[model samples]
Structures are given as structure tokens and as C-alpha cells.
Target: MNRFNWTYIDHKNERHHVGLMHGAQSGNLLVYCNTDILIIDFQVLHSHTYSFFIEEEFCELSIEKTADEQYLYSFDLNTEADTPLNRYRKKLSKKHLWQSLAFLAGFLILVFSLTISFTYWNKYNNQHQFAYGNGIQGRETIAQISIDPESEGKLVSYYFVANGKSYRANTKFKENATPFFKHGMPLIAGDEFVVKYAIDDPTINEIDYNRPSRKQISTYRNRAIERHLAFHPELDLDYCSCVADIAFKMKGINGLADLYFQRVSEEENPKHNINSYKRLVRSPKFTQRVEEKCWAQ
Candidate 1:
């Protein structure tokens, strides 16, 4: 048996305070409203509201939206029966207890495994990070670019040689776009950028370009490009600059051995016309020219 103290106003605007009781034997809620008694089935519409039907109309009651009424009710439902259905329900609750405990044990084991894995990964990362510092300045001898076979569309890898040693790095694009260089510029093969190494051990290396050596390399490359433009007036300064930048970085070259240019124009459609070629020629004799005229033995 459950009882609630409630107050409601009638049609005469008189407040009537009464005790609303649930009869467990009858399985009906007892509501006494102004000299009349109404029996309604107890139902919960949601967490905040309780509902019951009276005279073919739905009635809603909630603590937050109470117009001029209040009620105190118990959440626990009390029932009594010696039926087989009641006995079966009690048996089912006891059976579910072991299943609940097993689920909890599995959840705890998964959490423990993840914790151990994360700890091991953190330890490995910290040890490797400490070994590699800003790398030493090393001249790039060769630069190789290749499309990644494992991925589709604009997945690439850049492999380069510095001081007779090889290194690899990867890049991907959202669209078909040129690979970016340091500072988000277009990256070309044979471009000279600073390489980083560990201070204690030089073998641990990386190509992150925020190094002090880049400024000195850029200055040297610019001087070589100026020398190339002096000898060839027909070549665009911008085109010669790109070639010289790659050449000087690759082999400390003062000028390119071969210079070539091309232009494509369509008379029918101006929009389809390519004004000039973007690629710079890399000559086989370029290294020989650098060895003869630039660096002395």
C-alpha cells in the first residue's frame, strides 16, 4: 500500500486537501476529489510527469507545472501475490545478477589492456624524441619523387640524399596539387633545404626546415642564379632562378649547363593556351660544370 498527500481546487474555487492511496489488492489508485472517489490506473508518462485517464480524457500532472496543487508520492510500488507469475519474476532477477557481474569484469579487463598499451607507446615516443634534435647542415645530392602505389590520388613520397645518406618523407593532398615545400611553396626535386640531426648523435636525422642553415644556403643559391642570368638574356629570370636554386643545392653549382624554354598557344581558343612551360631542364653535364668552375679541389 502506498499513500500520497495531495491538494486540488474544485469548481467552487475551494481547495480540498486529501490522502491519495494506491490499493495493492485492487491494483487501482484511489483519488478523493470533493465528495466523490475516483479510481485511476497509475502510469508514468515521463520522468517529470505522471498521467492517468478520467472520463475518456487524459490528465497530466507534474511538480514543475502544478497550477494550484501539490502531491507527495512514493516511487516504490508495493504488491502482494502468491501467484506462479510473481514467483517466476523473483527467480529471473536472481539469475540476471551473475550475468551483470560477468559484463562488469569484461569491461574492466578491456580498460586495463588499453592503459598498458598507451603507457608503452608513450615511453617509446619520448625515448626517440630525445635522441633527435635540430639536424646538422648537409648538402642534398639527389632528390627523388614518386607516386605512392598503396594510395589513390595525390599520395606521394619524397626521398633525398644528404651527405651520401638517404632519407624518406611522405605527403598527401586533398586534390591533385603540387607538393608543398618549406613555408608552403611548391616543392621541386633537387631543391636544397636544411636537414636536421641529433646534437649528440648525427645519425638520427630529419628534414624539418626550421633550421639555422637554410638562410646561408638560400643566399648562396640566389648568387648562383644571378650569375646564370648575366650570361643568358633570352631566359626568363624567374625560370633561371628555379633551375639555379636546384643546381646549386645539388652540387654547389654556379650556373646550369643546359638552358631550354618552350611556349604553347592556341589561335582558336585563347583559354586553352599554355603561355609557357613550368618545368626546368636537369642536364647530365650539370654536375661536371659545378666541379670545373665552382668548387676547387
Candidate 2:
């Protein structure tokens, strides 16, 4: 339940106090203008607008549901007839609306320009090794290759050791141009690859996938299973292994890695990863396969 209060000055130079009480879960609403009860509806499950009269002035009260399942209450006074005050308020409202839209458009354009400039700058820095000739060649291991479910983009995480310190970084590419696909071979975890980084700031680096690793895939599936269980401690090892095996067979190692570690924050949406995993495990094909392979007595 939440309560909101505000003050309104009417055309008659009279001051009125407006108030609203809303029950978020119970779907109840109550509106007040001054000492008078304007609207009372105990079954407001959705957004609605109410029309009424305050003295000779027409008024409208709107109740809207927001994205986070909260209610927003708004009141507009003397909007129906073209009275002097109504016309003035209409002009003022239009002025404010236009000002707000203009501000938003300008802000978005500025952001777009900054983003484009920064992207080009970063690309140039990486290409030219920050304009410093102190860049040294380093070997980075393929820690993980994750595929985004929505965009089908590949994110590759790798790490390199410099001056006895390990630095981890990730890069993104479209599904077609993944760095993991090299010389008609799909690279996996534990395979070492080539990268170039600045000697002063090793973090400023880029992948050089033209030089592929000689090492083969090693324990990639096992590592994915371990990571999945680490993230979802509520699940048993047996269940995790079962799901990992099924996902690998169905979608291969990249899909399995994405399912296990696609970087969803637990603090943001605690149940997001588990909920997606549950949906997959509950699917008919997954359920049948798990029962046949994992649950066999």
C-alpha cells in the first residue's frame, strides 16, 4: 500500500489538497480532493481514468500501472471547456512537453555521438597498440566462449600473465566471425592463443587469432559443469552433470558454456539463471533425455 499527496490551485483562486491511496497487491484505489472523496474503487486491477466535476470546473483523474507493478496517480483540473485558465494551462503543458522532448532528443544525440567517438578511438588505440612501440606478444588461454541467447553473439573470455600478474579480458563478435573458429577448427578452453598488449598497461590488448594454439580441447565440458554447480549451489552434482551433458550434445560446447556462465548478476535478478535452467530442464525433449541417460536405475 502507498499514499501520495499534492496541492492543486483551481481557477476560482481556491486551494485544494489532493490525495491518493493505492494497494499494489490488493488492487484497491481511493482518491481525495480537499475534504471531499472523489473516487473509490476497490477492484482496480488495471489502469483507468475517471472524469468528474469540481464545482463548475471539469476534472480528470488517471491511475496508471508502471513497469515495476506500481501505480501512478495523476489529476488534471479544468481541461474540458475552453476557459481562460484551461487554455493557459494547455499552453503551459504543451510548452513543458516540448521542452522535455527536446531535452531528451538532445541528450540521446549527445550520447550517440560520444559512443561512436569512443568506439572509434578505442579501436584505433587497439590497432596501433596505443601508439607506443612497447607492445609485447603474449599467450592467452581460452577461458570460456559464451553465446548470447538473444543476439546470438559470441563473447570470448581469455586471460594472460604479464610480469607475474594475471589479467582477464573479454571480447565480443558476431556468431559468424568468432575468434574460436580458426583454420576450420573450433578452439575450446585450456587452448593457448596469441595476443598483443602494451608493456606499460597490459590491459590495453587485442586478440591475434591468426596465430592459433597447438593444444587441443581439454576438460572443457567438465569445467562448464563445475562452473554451473558453483553458480547454482542449490542443485546437486548429478542434476548439473545431467543437464550439462544434454546441453553439450544438443548445442555443443559453446551452448553448454553459455547456459552455465553467460554472466547474469545474481543480485539483480536472483532467480533468472535458475528459472531459465528450470524451463530448459522441464522441456519435453530435455526431460526425456535426462530420464533415459541420467536417471537410469
Candidate 3:
């Protein structure tokens, strides 16, 4: 017999006493109370131990082991088995927790890969529209610059003419050229710029800023003045003549004048990317920009 305090309540009555229990050979329990004998069959009964205390009114009466190492029970005659919500919390050991984390990480990676693929496809579609569209050949011209309505002032698109028809298209500026990579060429209203375009599809075009006008060249010279002075303060070279020649001759290859002055400053410091003079001699554009724009001075 397992001994523990037992409480029972009937309508308008309460009783408290010891409970005695005995198991029979047939796997049934005989519980003896003050005035009643209750028989429970092991085959038909489900039991659980309460690791936490539960209120008598809400408790699921299951045969339980108390902290004192005694077997006891609360009898709920209405229910035979535990409901899902009342069942014990399934233990999640560290190994299982790690497995769950790994699954979540893999799911996030899949989502990120899909997002990137979609974004790349979207950009490619835009690029294809501009690259393969048809346009009439026209003399080099300066495109009128306007704020892109779709992107606000954050970006600008160019409007040009081909075959006497006006067309609009956005040009792809190099990354980090300004705030947004799509900011287009930073050309002014009257700045000399040109593009190849399809007559039927003006949005499909290629812009060329290689041949700037005299005003544009002057602007470039002014902008580069501070930089040139910072690098070669004592030098007496004219900024416009130095940079415009290199820009038109080299099609705006970067670091030309800087590298030239760098060599002049320290001849022993080996030449930069432009190591071969023969390469420049072979370029007709180089001779043309120099003869027409630079050495004419």
C-alpha cells in the first residue's frame, strides 16, 4: 500500500483520509478508502506523473509519483486519456536544437538565392531592351538631360534625335559614379554628348560622352585643377590641355595626366599602366585629340 493524504468532496460534504492500494495478479489495482473499494484495470487505464503541481479542478487525474517517493492519484471520472494540450513538453536536446537551426539557415539561403536571381533577371531584361533596339545613325550630338520621372531627381535620362524623331532612353552610368549607378551620364543641358539610336525604339540607345564640346572641356579642366594642383603644385602645365588631350585621345582612360606627372615627379618609380609609348603611337584617336585639342596650344 502507498500511503498519502487523500481528499474527496461530495455535494455539501468533504472528507480527508489515507488511501491504501494493492495490485492483483491480473494487473488490476484495488484502492481502499474509508468506505469504498475502487478497482482499476491496467489494460484500460492511461497514467502520467505530474512534474508540476496542478489545481484539483483543472487537474487531469492520473496515477502520479510525488516528491516523497510515494505513489498517489487524483481520479477524474470524466476523461480516460490526456488531451494534446496537457501533454508533457517534448524535450529538445542541444543536438535537435542545432538540427532545427541548420534547417532554418538552409531555408534562408534558398530565399536569398531566389531573390538575387530575380533581381539579376530583371536588370538583364532592362539591359536587353536598350542593347538590341533599333535606331537611325546620326551625327554626334549633345543629348538634352532631364530628371527621370520614375526615379525622381535621383536619376536622369537623355533625350536625343535620330531621323528627325525625338527619343528618350536611360544610359547606364558606371557604378559609384554618383549616388545611384543608374544616375546616367552627368551631362548638362548644352553639354556635347552623342548616342546611337533605333528610329522606332528610342529607348534602346547607346550614349557616348567621348567628344565633349569646348564648354564641357573647360568644365572638366576646372574640375581637375584642384586635383592636379594637389598632386603637382610646382608644375606649370595647363590642366585643360593636359587632360582633354588625354581624355579624347584615350577615350577617357583614367589616370593619364596623373600618371604622366607621377613619372615626372619620380622617373625611377617605374611607369604606371601606360608603360609602352608605341601603343599610344598606334592609336589614331590619341594623335587626333593631341593635334586638334592639346598641342595646338
Per-model TM-score versus the true fold:
0.28, 0.31, 0.30
User: Would you list the rank order by TM-score, best first?
Assistant: 2, 3, 1
Q: TM-score of model 2 relative to the true fold?
A: 0.31
Error of 3 at 257 (Å): 6.9
Best by TM-score: 2
lDDT of 3 by residue, 165-245 (tens): 777766443222432111112344444455665444445457756655566555545544544456657744664446434
- Model 1 misplaced regions, further than 4 Å: 1-113, 116-146, 158-185, 188-206, 209-297
Q: Candidate 1 has what TM-score? A: 0.28
Please tell me which model should have the higher TM-score, number 1 or number 3: 3
What is the Cα-based lDDT of residue 124 in candidate 2?
Answer: 73
Candidate 2 ranges with C-alpha deviation above 4 Å: 1-86, 93-97, 108-112, 123-125, 128-155, 163-166, 169-185, 210-297
Candidate 3's displacement at residue 292, Å, is 20
Please report how far candidate 2 places residue 153 from its true position, in Å. 7.4
What would the per-residue lDDT of candidate 1 be over residues 39-86, giving only the tens digit for each residue?
A: 455542222434543332234443231344333353221123444444
> Model 3 off-target regions past 4 Å?
1-140, 144-153, 162-166, 172-191, 209-222, 230-297
lDDT of 2 by residue, 1-297 (tens): 878887877667988888888888887888888889988888786899988777667777888888887777888874757766677788999999999999999999999999999998876766575534445444344332344446435554677777678777766655546433422224454456666666656776666554544332235556667877887899788887877878767655544545554455555334334454566667898889988887773
Model 2 / residue 146 / CA error / Å: 7.9
TM-score quality measure for candidate 3: 0.30
